[model samples]
Target: MSDVLKLEAPLGDVIRKSKLKAIKSIVSSFQPINNDKIEFKNNEHSDKNISLDKIQIVANRFITIKRLGSGGFGEVYLAKDKNQNDLLIAIKFENINTSRPQLSIEKYVFEIMYECSYIPKMFYFGIHNEYTVLAMDLLGPSVEDLLNFCGRKFSLKTICMIMEQILRGIEALHNHSLVHRDLKPDNFLFGLGMKSHIVHLIDFGLCKNYRHPLTYEHILYRTGKTLTGTARYCSLYTHHGLEQSRRDDIECLSYIIIYLAKGFLPWMSIKNSNRKKRNEKLMEIK
Candidate 1:
């Protein structure tokens, strides 16, 4: 066991104030896992923990069948488009505090990298009355949720198979020099039924695009920030907001594989953080 990262600080408050204006400045910047020591700042005010009904989703001619789920940036819904097309689309509604340029970047990234089997194909993205929303092909239950329902951990064979498919998807992003900075069990869908099921890569909202879509010389503007991924599985360079490489993806992939084999996170803390000292104790071993 090791020092695990957890925060007493009300991070939600800080996020809202940002209005998610910057590209890589969101919660993804906060290393949420093995970073271990967290020094809380009580300087932020919180976003109103509004009731679910407070925000609304209105798509043209599409009726919401049910809400698929919500994430740090937005909630995805299952819906039917016009002409009664049996469409499974995810609508992501980002709060003012979450982001908007994410919508533009996601479109440019996924739209260009079409044809990878596992990455959920994006249909369209645009502002629906000042709110940034995305429509992606709705995917099935995520692997993390499935593992919980499976009761026991996955078979080694199953884990390998899932990893293979995920790598297939990651390879596409790697080719484009983009990083799915937020890779986790929760981001993959293992599909439904007895036959071969589809495994999909979902949620590119936290994706890191290296192209630097706009022109700005600021370091954060030049590269990117580690704004939206979990720390346990995040690579070291990503912690510094550097655009990730194929090597970095491999590192994160290693962490997830280890997590599946063991029942807990590999770097999880057994004691309260002593992060300031002996932090690199495990570095030499790795």
Candidate 2:
């Protein structure tokens, strides 16, 4: 969400009464303060969906403005805050999904990387009504839109810069043991003019704090789900949900770089499994 949402996130004690017992249960299970990985695509659970019959907002001071985007979860709102001391924020408001855990996990991960220059800073997070709201810094245009305008053409220097920033963002996440399994140009944002652009890591909705063991089935190994990223940039293990690390981010970014430089993917020559075919085309890139 950016300066582009409809249902905005309100500040202060906007959280109201809901399934108190269930909320407390989840908080307790996560142990209030035992750091765990954030869930972008959380497993569906029986108690995932809950009714919000309780909760209230304290600093209820927001002015609704426009719609950013809409999807299965809910609509994002771009709004202004009279009490925000003159600041812009992107608000994400989703209906109660006590079963789903992505927002909660996103709050934690965004908070952790809030200080990283490579990532946007989050402003606030809370659960209100039958909706969970996450307020964050207003980032700009999506890289996909930018690419459409640039049209398969970019200087090698620009590609290198983008790759560097992507690396920095990935390194920041890895340093904290977080894995942004879903990475593509659309997840990145840049300034309007594109001259002075900043690549933001957004949509923590699918992020994973992968739990990898150093050793496995007779050898040192790792294990995890094989939730593939965008069809264009994902790797083999990423597609299989096997394992993810800093290197995967690099590989994915490489796809963007090649796309920008050549106006077409190297893999255009082959049409096999994205992981297999894309990997085969890697050598021809650059």
Candidate 3:
């Protein structure tokens, strides 16, 4: 038995070394983009003059490859880390001068939940030029994107597998005393490369600590609060202007699962130009 164990140990070591060598070779062969001549866009409408140099490289390491998407908070870009074997990363930029800044709060949440596997690995968070920047692991297409790709619906087996991971992710956040107020299909994204099947929960701009961090006591229920998340997937309690709890998160997840399976929610067609009336109609149908 001792002789057999010794042989197996050496064989395992050899296999690991071979894998490491292959990975290193692949990384070494990768061609990094030349960012010296890259042209970054500057918004002329902004009062602050954002220079071209400030928006090019972030943290003195990552180079912006291209803009991926933009929302009310800011824009997200595909960047490459020059210091880390030219590894691809996603960088979110929020204008420092914006009236409502949420990237800092998002950064704090990322720091607290860094150990959770379902959370994206935060690489860097700091000020770069006129924007507050956050760099993280580049994730693949979101569940919403996949839904469109799959002709607007997912199979039962696919939904089962996706929901299992999404539930685990929510459980992890709740265990940490946080509630993801903004739970939707767009925020749940698949991992890249070999981890394509792994689901990652993102967009913590609206997340909140639902309990006392140290004492673990839940927060007091409140009323007459403005809605904090997407109206479509939010719980009934949220629509009623009540504080969200762990149950609200689960309720939102249930709505998301139903949407994935059915390809559309009943209230999706509510298109009243007035936000208040639209929400009222949605509440009535919901």
Candidate of highest TM-score: 3
lDDT of 2 by residue, 101-187 (tens): 446666777777878877766666777566777666666555554444444455555566567777788888777766665677667
Give the alpha carbon lDDT tens digit for every residue of 196-263 in model 1: 25566765645554443354222233244422355657677655555554566688889888876664
What 10-residue stretch in candidate 2 is worst by lDDT?
A: 23-32
Worst 10 residues of 1 by lDDT: 23-32
Off by over 4 Å in 3: 1-55
lDDT of 2: 0.52
What TM-score would every model get versus the actual structure? 0.65, 0.66, 0.79
Best-to-worst ranking by lDDT: 3, 2, 1
Q: Mind giving the per-residue lDDT tens digits that candidate 3 earns over 219-276?
A: 8888877766788998899889787889999999889988988889999998988877
lDDT of each: 0.51, 0.52, 0.69
* TM-score-best of 1 and 2: 2
Instruction: Assess the local accuracy of residue 106 in candidate 2 as a C-alpha lDDT between 0 and 100.
Output: 65
